[model samples]
Target: MAVTGISANRLELLSIADAVAREKNIDREIVIDAIEEAIQKGAKSRYGAHHDIRAKIDHKTGELSLTRHTTIVADDWEPEDELEEFNDSAMVRLRDALKRDPEAEIGKEYIEVLPPFEFGRVQTQMARQVVTGKVREAERANQYEEFKDRVGEIVNGTVKRVEYGNTIVDLGRGEGIMRRDQSIPREVFNVGDRVRTYIYDVRPEAKGPQVMLSRAHPGFMAKLFSQEVPEVYDGVIEIRAAARDAGSRAKMAVLSNDSSIDPVGACVGMRGSRVQAVVAELQGEKIDIIPWVDDEPTFIVNALAPAEVSKVVLDEDADRVEVVVPDDQLSLAIGRRGQNVRLASQLTGWQIDIITEAQDSERRQKEFAERTGLFQEALDVDETIAQLLVTEGFATVEDLAYVEAYEVAEIEGFDEDTAEELQTRAREFLERQATELDNKRKALGVEDGVLEIEGVTPQMAVALGEGGVKTIEDLADLATDEIRGGHEIRGGERVKLAGVLESFNLSQEAAELLILRARVAAGWIDASELPQPEPEPEPEFEDVEGEDAFAREYDDAEGEVEAVEPEGDTDEPQDA
Candidate 1:
């Protein structure tokens, strides 16, 4: 067949499709599909547009065919189903179709061969454009599918162009975009520079697939190490966690599967060759390779290596840790602008606070003295008794009041009578303190609604009122964190909303419950409207006999229908 000024050759068409597919790095089938679609469009222009025209290509020979398709239907058929639309060009009566095929049936398609058209210059140009557009679209879809699963993988590409601080990388088969923020700090790139980046995201858009590349991502450093270290790549040395300060510094926690292999030594290589390679790729980003430990305190000590830890105190409830180091190591442990502790926190998933041994010792002495003084004043006990109580882990008057008589008596140099007296004094002191706080709450104009919440004591209510949260609605408006920690204002000034609640020492769960109660009281939520679990579905009767028996048994069961009916429906079914 010949187009107006164009000739169709099966071998030449196949060659062109193979070349295009190779150049686009797409499947040859996609190129053939594009060609078929382009030919179908051209056929529609040459023939009637209203005809149900279709086109296909012979995969092996690349021979193209254009045809008109008509659906065979009953002679008296009326379009009822959504698929059976009335169209003269799409359907043929059964009788008419049977003339061509005596065994023709309704819903079977009839294909009529059409003569291939000769294409004009304008038509050829249009077909070429259509094929090119389809190929480009297919290329994008292929790119998306290829890179979507590769997210979090490290990719190597050459810098193609830099536009407004955004680097466009030629990934050989596709392009990737590295936004300025995703690049390492102060890192510079030029055209044709070899770049290694993490494929952080692949977004499919109308224009094309957006392949997001990043160098500052922690995963990039992990991948770099994986590439440099055989043990890491082989999963013998597993990177437990990584935290990066971009081009400045990074910390990684690694664990070894084989007890014989040292994770840190494997990552560092001989004379730091392995780690140095990763650092060079990151533009000299200093990386600290620490061995991962299951014990958090020991792990933190490892993370803060080179700084000898004098003591480590963990506040498990708050997920925070305090590291006390030697006076000389304090600066090193904290790092410049607290980077060391910050990275350690990130790696360990805990909040870390560092202090000198001297400072920690001073704080401890102060706390002991304060507890001794509190017991002395509240329990009317002497220094010795107060010291004993403090040493026994009684930090507050409330602790002494709430302890069992036997527990108090178990302390050294204390009997049952002494325990009872101490308990009485503790309770009396607390009652007096509560009375004073209640008077203050009233004086502060704290509403009764605010005082009624479970976690809000009289002192907390007064604090809330002082902080401008005088109503139940005000307390309800506060977030759980706000009630627990309050917020810091400008110039480091903290607005203490629930700071007074610290005396009560409520747990996070208690504080949240208190906030929920306040919300309920403020009519923000219904207390009884908690989410209920969905009931399990009834078992299906698998056998036909069982199913039929169930149906009959259910039908004979009296009041079964009435029991399942909606409440308050009085209408009954008439006798059928």
Candidate 2:
């Protein structure tokens, strides 16, 4: 009866391992390894903690073996940690092992088989904990591997539970959490409810792999469209960009490779059937599917549909676009709380400023009057002459001072002597202005070294001094945004922070260059470390005809082409 019981227990151990592996969806070998470790720990607790106990189970015979290993070591061998005392039970000195075996050597391990014994309550508990911990670790690892690459894919799951407005989803193989912010506004779920979500991220944590799910992600809309539109799935159409305002509104820009198939129409389906399905899934969030184009200005115009745009001026340096709409369309273009413009900006990756035609016209008139006054005051020219200069695109006294005399003389009603007189007056006025600015800068306690940096003008030096930057070191310490202007969140609202050189309208690259030069002047960096300008490629000449010839030749010589002179000069001051 004793022999039969022992055999039955050994078979039962293997059967338990198989059941656990099957239930955990892990490999049988892993469960077997975990069991071996558990048995080894139990043996160590029973035989004495100092003994090197090991356990193994036969794969086919369902047989268990336990042993105590004594490793032979040289006399000089010591414990790895200085504070740890030598473990004499598990280790034998080489000299001591030679007494029992003549051919004893270092690293020779002698093993003594241990008889199987019944487990006590404490031992059974420890074994269970060890097996459970190892199996849990394996399950977590398996879950991570299964879901890591599934990011950006829409998945179906059942709602496992809701904690503090976060939904825990059961994805069969793993669990995913959809935080409140990631779900559609006002969307609620109960336990066991089927839910569809997008897997945006999978992060491994100590507790387990965190499967992050979302219904409001821009990618969620895109994936839904792909599922509904056959052309999008088969690569006939591509969704280039998508943006969402959760339950309120969304926008998607798509492109069609096949000209016969309209990308927007295909996504909309027959009589809006396809889009309706998506809207249902998103809890009635309005979606606008616009056809994407390579031309950024045209694409932005399409993005702001139902609102007529009069003009769009893109400032590529700042990644910003100023859109002018009809006065009546202002509310529509900006949408409720600026939603329309905001979504368009996100889709196009540009900061958008929307204004009515009246606003734009007013701003233009203000600029023209300012420029005309500047010329009139600086060059001692009459109002008519200043208006003429402003209409002719002479923005400042500096433009007339450095321009070719012939170019100025070529203006209607202006002769060579008149151009010469204007040019002389401009140069003299600029000299006086520079002297005044230099005096102002010095009065503000601006160090003379600040003016030594390349690209720093006397006016800029004065501006810097007024902004509390008086020395090269002070300028070097400023970030590009501090010098170029940016938006900052202050008191829970975004406020525009004026830059020191905001009036100068410096480009981002120009601001960085100024800081870099200041750093070099302050001895913070070697001058040689400054970036070198890339050599311009030689211009390829092609045969040009008619009006383009002169402009092309001038552009090739000057490395920049001047703006075309407006047709029919008028006293009303044509727009520049």
Best by TM-score: 2
Per-candidate TM equals: 0.73, 0.86
The runs of at least 3 residues in candidate 1 whose Cα sits more than 4 Å from the true structure, single-residue gaps closed, are 5-12, 45-51, 70-114, 118-126, 149-154, 185-187, 380-387, 410-415, 431-576
Clashing residue pairs found in predicted model 1? 3-118, 3-119, 4-118, 4-119
* lDDT against true structure, model 1: 0.80
lDDT (10s digit) by residue, model 2, range 1-576 = 011223556787778889999999998888888888888888888889999999888877778888999999998986789788768999999988999999999999999998878777777788889989999999999999999999999999999999999999999998999999999999999999999999999999999999999999999999998899999999999999998999999988888999899877888888889999999999999998887766566677778876766667766666787788899999999999999899989999989888898998999899889988998888888989899888887777888899999999999999999999999999999899889999999999999999999999998999999999998999999998889789999999999998999888888888999999999999999999888999999987665343212221132321332222122321110000
Clashes of each: 4, 0
Best by lDDT: 2
How well is each residue in 402-486 modelled by candidate 1, as lDDT tens digits?
A: 8889999999899999999999999999999999888888888788878887667777888787777889998888776666666
Q: Whole-model lDDT for model 2 versus the true structure?
A: 0.85
